[model samples]
Target: MMAGSGRDESGAGGVDDAVRELLLLMPRMVGRVKRIPVPEALQSQSLAPRHLSLLSCLLFDGPMSVNELAARLEVAPTTVSLMVADLSAKGILDRRADPADRRRRIVAIVPERHDAIAAWLAPGAAAWRRVLTPLAPAQRRLFVDTLRAYEAAVAEERREE
Candidate 1:
């Protein structure tokens, strides 16, 4: 029954609490940082955070329909549709009639703009690296492993649901 009790009690409670607190606060802290005013050059033609998130999803998951994107973003279809339309017009995304279903449109990142998207994401990427850089090699490995385990658990829960 309690197969993990010994391991869980071996100073793991403190580690679990620390991890939980970091998980709870990191998002809020990063969101606050993201909301701070951007430099003039960056602000002149910056994408909103929501748009960045949508782009990131498309970049990672490949092509997706408006409905699928809405589900992934947990937003209204109309909202994703509008965002897709904007990105399409900006040439960052390509929208075409889905081959499997002409009634639906599929959106994907434009190959030509991948570099631009990566450049746009550079600051956030660097910030994340900086945050992890202070950790020792072993701690870094443990942190990454823990995050992967957490992600796997979440995926399994979603599948069961």
Candidate 2:
């Protein structure tokens, strides 16, 4: 297996190929994402890239406290708090006292805006789905499983640092 050609089969023969393909493709994908126009609704909101990152974090991880968000983003809690405050002012996010801990506030994306964000992301999702559409059912299952395992490995590498 040629290491650079991405033909290596780490486990499932095509798993390494897929992983390498994705690794190579990631930067271009990110570049495309960075170019996604800020929708009219968000344009007047004074949102920054970091704010979008925060929104993505909340969208995927569910509501979390300021400290948790800070830890996840590797920033200060005060930073997350300020960003949350700004987004809340724009009606893009909601903040409420945590049910389990009144002293803590749980921040979340407004349900109404979730679809807008999803729309912004829809093209990329569609592109991947299109790529996967022709594969056999079992292969699609393997792809998902392989993707999850790859994500875990990457996350573990980050943790070790």
Candidate 3:
């Protein structure tokens, strides 16, 4: 496949094309969204992309150990430790000794900051909603289903490796 193109041997070439287009567009789209100037209230404590990604992972997956986080992020353990410490100091993350293993530390999103993070994500969420609004309900459902299938396929491939 080309950098931004997908080849389809089957009859679902249009679906493959749409998926490929979305894959190509999403990174650029998110980069633009990330570059949107932060509001004055949030500017003083703006988050880097990595920080936001870590927070998102914690928010969605709940508490996790440094090693686990490193695996999920595909980063060095020391890198995750640094990030965890930085986020903890910033009050965006909280770290505690794991109950199951006192030797391990668990990091989780700060509950108090959930609203702030959600608010900061509102613009990007709204943009996606608006983009999907043009699609018919059935088409939207199919699109989401297709994406989920694609995600599962990718995960399966990773597991096999």
Local distance difference test values of all predictions, in order? 0.78, 0.82, 0.78
Q: Report the C-alpha lDDT of model 3 over 37-145, residue by residue, as the tens digit.
A: 6544446665687876676677667899989888988779999999888878877789898998898889987787777676776677688799899999999999889
Clashing pairs in 1: none
Name model 3 segments beyond 4 Å from true. 1-31, 36-42, 122-161
In model 3, the clashing pairs are: none
User: Can you tell me which runs of candidate 2 are displaced by over 4 Å?
Assistant: 1-31, 124-161
For each candidate in turn, the TM-score is: 0.53, 0.58, 0.57
**Which pairs clash in model 2?**
none
Please write out the lDDT profile of model 1 over residues 31-82, one tens digit for every residue.
8668655544345444688888798787767899999999988789999989
Between candidates 2 and 3, the lDDT winner: 2
The clash count of every prediction, one per candidate, is 0, 0, 0
Candidate 2, 88-158: lDDT as tens digits: 98899999999998998999889888878767667766887899999999999998898778778889989
Give the range where candidate 1 is weakest over 10 consecutive residues by summed lDDT.
1-10
In candidate 3, where is summed lDDT lowest over 10 consecutive residues? 1-10
Which should have the higher TM-score, number 1 or number 2? Answer: 2
Q: Looking at model 2, report the run of 10 residues with the lowest lDDT sum.
A: 4-13
